[model samples]
Target: MFGGVTIGEFARLTHLSVRTLRRYHESGLLAPATVDPDSGYRYYTADQIPTAQVIHQLRELDVPLADVAKILATEDAEERAGLAGEHLRRLEAELARTRAAVLSLRRLLRPHDDTLRVELRKIAARTVAGIEDVVAQDDVLSWYDEAMAELDAAIESRPLGPPGGRYANELFTDGRGTVLVYRPVADPPVRGRVHPVHLPPSELAVVVHPGPHDDIGVTYGRLGAWVVDHALAVDGPVHETYLVGPRDTPDPAAWRTEIGWPVFRLAVTDVMPGKNPGQTGNPPP
Candidate 1:
């Protein structure tokens, strides 16, 4: 009203809708310079055009309404810039996630050979320095990192073999279960969460998964299918040997993980009923 402009005229001048102006007034983000008591009309001055434009720009960036209000209420120019910068960082993170998802989806849609080279191995039992916890699936990454750091610090010397872990089936199926990370040591010092534990020997159907772990599930699926086809799968926890992981190398292409599933040989009768070739009903010694 100071500039003799109605709400409609201000809306056109600011390139903002009347509805948005009404909302900004109600939200206390921007109030008109005057309101007619008799006609219940809203009026704005020329000074508010810049304020309305700023609000429109902030909202266009998808900034939350509360944050927008905070930015407007702040008197310090640096504080206002910081608030906007924080939201920009969040948007950048989201964009990164979107890019990763797109790459994964492209790989999934493109058909490629699912055949993986697998091996049968018998591992001997050994005592290892280890940590076990019931962890949620979402927290597994950070939990693993911390657990590995603890084990590295506790062990005085290098590991006897590659770092490995055992994951209970329920962990994958139920999204929360037991996970054990271990490093083999000749004589490991037991301190803190690190303790000496015996790992049992077992026959395993092992397969190597190369590259990053983002799509390792596809390799696991193929390996499980192989085990089922051979009728060698047993009810036991899955073992993982990190041959070349993030700690070993920064290049994901060079990473190699050995996935082991406990298995047992099928009996002759089970393989071919009533047609035995003098084979014993036990795994090869």
Candidate 2:
């Protein structure tokens, strides 16, 4: 005790509580300078003041206790900086998501009466020459770039139809993204690694998106609402028929994607089925 500082006095000087100091000792983060054998009392020297203050600053930055212990165990400057840099990137991504949510809420609250035009259309079957892949939703953008490059090399003539995306059942429920590119032509070859998928006949609730793909979620919500109002339910994954893409159109403002929700006629009857003797569809036990 160079400055005559006891454990309690040292905690006050370092802006740390007595309980916290004791916990740090147990965690091997910071240990006291001296300890009594028989009395079991703890004491600290003035030189340990800087160590206590450093721990205080680190805890204030939201660093986990385990990570703080690792930082103290290693003396490598580069490794410590690397950990901090990774945490900073995660914080930035979280902030961006929070900002996007705020903007969406603001858009919903604004007064507007721009009614969306709902159309029921039948899509004809056409041959497309492009690449297809199963991609994770988070990595879909990068996958699209690679697939487009393959399409450009495989196809001799330029794409006649728009670039589009096809979703499978697992896409929405499990976050699995399946994308397919289509080019219109007669008797397209289905050889090499390309797989041919036929477009099924069904009633589709179609809406034309007139801008970029940034806020496509807004259009999806509006279309679903329309389908609900008409007592129509979608039984399949949604499909986006891109009328314009980077290869066909240079201006993003002119880009168009025909978003279609597959739906069918609901058969309503005034008949009810008899309950089984042992099973009455009761709530689970």
Q: Using lDDT as the measure, which candidate wins?
A: 1
Candidate 2 deviation (Cα RMSD): 11.6
lDDT per prediction?
0.85, 0.69
Q: Which predicted model would earn the best TM-score? A: 1
The alpha-carbon deviation from the true structure for residue 192 of candidate 1, after best TM-score superposition, in angstroms, is 0.8
Tens digits of per-residue lDDT for model 1, 1-285: 344589999989998999999999998889998898888788898888989999999888899899999999998999999998998888887876676566567666778664567777799999999999999987887799999999999999878999999999989999998999999999977899999989999888889988887677777877877777656756589999999999999999999999999988665236544543343322232
Mark the regions of model 2 whose C-alpha exceeds 4 Å error after superposition.
1-103, 190-192, 248-251, 267-285
Model 2, range 1-285, lDDT digits (tens) per residue?
233467788888888999999988888888777677776668888878877886777777677788777776767889977876666677766776676576556656767545666676667765566567787877776777776676656566555566666676676668886667655544455656454556666667788877666566777888888777555678776878878766667887788888988876453121123433233211111
Provide the clashing-pair count of each candidate structure: 0, 1
